[model samples]
Target: MRLIQIINDIRLKRKLSLIFITVAVLPLLISGIYLTNKLREVMVSNAFEQASDNVERVQKRTAEVINVALDISYQLSNDNRMKSIASRSYDSYNEVIQTYRQYTDIRDYVRLYKEIKAIRLYASNPTMLNNWEFMQPDEQTTKEAWYVSALNKKGLAGWGYIQDERDQKHYLSLVRKINLDDLKNESVLVINVNSDLLNSILSQESFATMIVDDSNNIVAANRPDLYGKNLSAVHAESNMLWQSEGSFDAVMNGKNSKVVIANLNPQNSWNGLRIISIFTISDIVHDANAVIRISAFVVGGCLVIAVLLVYASASLITGRLLRLSKHMSQVGTLSWDSYLDLDGKDEIGQLSRQFNALVHRISQLMFEVEESNQQKQLLLQKQNDIKFKMLASQVNPHFLFNTLESIRMEAHLRGEEDLAQAVWQLSILIRNSLEVGSRQIPLSEELNMVRCYLELHKFRFEDRLQYKMEIDPATEGIEIPPLIIQPLVENSILHGLDRKEDPTLITVRTRLNDHGELFVEIQDDGAGIPPKKMKDLTMRLMDSEEPGNRIGLRNVNDRLQLTYGQGARLSIESEEGRGTCITFCIPKKGVEPVVFSDNR
Candidate 1:
């Protein structure tokens, strides 16, 4: 409570300042920092995705090159002629030259395919001459690890960096043992894949990329300086590189970097290669940080402008309110002569003008108080006289009801039962017409009054007039305006039976319609109104003009519209010489409430 009082007591200017700081400044700063961090993350993520795609492309191209070499190796391994040439014992150098010239497939492969650098077959047959395509392995060549491994594998192919004996240059080569059919000696086939092809593929990439064999030797690289170097010498996570196959964060070139790795497993080869792409995270988000700096400057400028605007607006408002407050204090002294004189087109100026009008009104009211008191006494005396007259007017209805009762008793005493019954019914109709005027009555009570009215008519018309009621028991207690149905019943007898000698039947039905609304209908099988008269009656019922005479239909329509709105008005359907039906449905909501009463 004390804190609330303190806050309430603060000046408006200071309150606005606090709101600006908490609502605008703090949230702006927090959101700016959050967005900056999110943008940096998005930049890094996009960089990694591009690098991953680069690695995939390099792996695919590298696989294509390596697959070419493997296919060539398999074809040459199964070549019966090459196997025969390598395994057969040659007696002379001319025979060896002629044989090498005849088998021109190896030379055609290295010449026709850009991916194959060289193809060489090392034979252990001493009689075979050391031609460029077919070489006789010496002691040093047979002792090489690749040669020994290929020999130990018996028939499977192996891939590794092996130097061509002719050029003494190292290349990524596929080494396979080709077993002679009937001989114990095995010949080795080497297919050197062009390292330049792999290097060109990586050079076209944006990030630094390289293909490394399982031995950790960089076979090909976009960076020439890193070629042929072990991965451990250049990367810190070299030991763990083989452990992860996809991507990971690491330190490279003394900077934070993301590295993506993809594997290239060639067909029918013992060793597979890994394609690696590395890019620094800082390089990826460098542009994003510059954009954030400019955005921060713009946001700060806006906040400064907002602070100035808020302060200036607060000062202007508080100054006007303080001046108004001082003048309001003088109003306690009842000084109406001096009014507020503030000026402007704003709301405060309008308030000042209204205050002046109020002061003038107060002064005028003071002068009129005595004159109003003098008139009040005269109105009281007149009201008392009117009340006496209204009381006198109610006495006649009671006297008439008493006189009807006396007549009914006299008829009963004289043994005139029919006359007594007629008198009783007449009394009911007269009492309701006089006392229940324009008030709501229960449908059951209204029906009883209607019965009385109809019975009296029956006494006059005899068999010529007949009436029937089809009232749903559930609608007996529903309230409706008095005389709504009785007037229509009376109209039927007057218009139908009076003009014609034929009999007429009137039906009063009360039931719920499909929408659960109360539907009341009075239908008569008598001579209906003509078309012209019917049109005039409908127009008059809908019009707001005061009906000069025969206001029963118009009055009922007005009451229905006034009580239940326009949708509850009556519908009349009549045809000349046939019948007429007058129906009005009260929405179930309107019938549920007892909305009108005559307390008089």
Candidate 2:
């Protein structure tokens, strides 16, 4: 009877202890889930609100700066000074440059840097800035298209860029055209807008903000070195392009961001230029019901009471399990280099000692993984080395032209004047075809190459092939793919000019567009190709079609795609005998002075 009573009482106590532990665990689990969810929701919402608010502030400030640029153009268009320059003619370039020297302060009106981090270049005659032959901008002048556009358009023309002929400083050009009637000349008044003010605006808003003119070339940026790099989202981390042009939220820089795009032109002109503004995520929401974390005596008073009540049965299991979990979390990612540190005397200590031995086994396996990675990297390095060689050996037609140029020079020295001029022009054409190895080159360089080829054809046909270049000088040195213009010219010649009857005319035109691309048109009075054939030829431009032909046109197009990616391409337009006009656009990439890294 005594034994039966003892056993029954012990069983009842055990049952009671289990019930108490279950009740305690239920509350802890419920509280943990609720707290974790509440905290996450509150913090995430706060992050979103902060990003939105900060970008909104940046958007507003950027607008004011943009308006100032627009207003400067507006004010100058209606200025008495511009009217005076238009009405008078100066005898010397100094007189013309001095004519509107007073307007240099226009830079300040544009919110440019106070210390003047930028400068300007100007020409006295309209043709001096226009006529390709007389314009010699080697490294000191920037030819601005807005100068001429302002003359023709009669207002603030450039928020984009003209050629930076003067290599001394980088600037945003503010140009106005004055007819200067007295001298029978057009004087372009150029104001060099310092980049720092724009940079300051970007600095206020983001870690990095870039301003690209329609040609996609970096015009202004918080990081100036990035200027001249392409900003195509499809190709890089450039923010998603604004299709309809408005503000929106996005994921950027490991956090939320607000991107606002305002069309630079009023009346909601989608086709006109626009400005993109960005702001961070932290500035938007305020913290009110933020979830807070509580630590113990993690278990503290309540856990202690529960433990005391159940210690005789559950203490050993709970302690050992908690210790295992703690070591697991700490060992996994927190201390991969030192997960085997074990020194203790209890049950938890014995488990750690076993874990330390297991870790040593894992370490040997990791050593093999590291060895494999080293081998893989070595192979990758070898592959890249080979690609570098291929880049070098890939023949640029310009190499042949340079050889031809040397022959022409020899001919000139020997009094073969006609042959020398002919080869010189041919060399120029070839150079244009091969110039795209660098990140940037003048728009003029591209056109010059075209003109050289045109001149070459003119000689081949004994002047039957007539060609003219109508390039906006301001477009010179604005940067483009090295081979972008040449291929279009080649296509026009092969499919159009080469088979023309009577005297043929080919014209190459270059202009800056709002989408940040150079609209280059190559037109010819020759038979055109069928649409189907044109498309097929285009697709095969980069792929092999002819076994060993250079497929000069195709090769050049492929290169443009590779060099400039999305914003560069080749297309053809033609008719039976009416004429063929080929238009291809190149986005301006900034100057990368050295083409071959020669790192090897």
Q: Best by TM-score, which number?
A: 1
Model 2 residue 148 CA deviation (Å) reads 6.0
True-structure lDDT of candidate 1: 0.82
How many clashes in candidate 1?
A: 0
TM-score per model over all chains: 0.43, 0.35
Task: Report the lDDT tens digits of candidate 2 across residue range 1-600.
Answer: 664334233433454566575647765676667666665567556654543554455456555655554455455545555455445446777765565555554445434534233333333544222222123233233333454455565433455555454464446555554444443554455555556666676666433455666655565666656665655631243444544355566766576666655444432112234455554535432342435424232335557766665664455445555767777777686365655443335444566778877777777778898999999999999999999999999867656766897899899999998789998776665555455465556666666677776677677777667788888655675666565676677777777766766777788887777765667788888777778876766666656654455447766666667766855666666767678887767665532223333682
Worst 10 residues of 1 by lDDT: 3-12
lDDT of all predictions? 0.82, 0.58
Candidate 1, RMSD to the unseen true structure: 24.8
| For every candidate, C-alpha RMSD to the true structure in Å | 24.8, 27.0
Best candidate, lDDT: 1
lDDT of 1 by residue, 384-488 (tens): 999999987776777988999999999999999889999999998887777776567888889998899889998889888899999998888788887788878
Give Cα distance to truth, residue 236, candidate 1, Å: 3.8
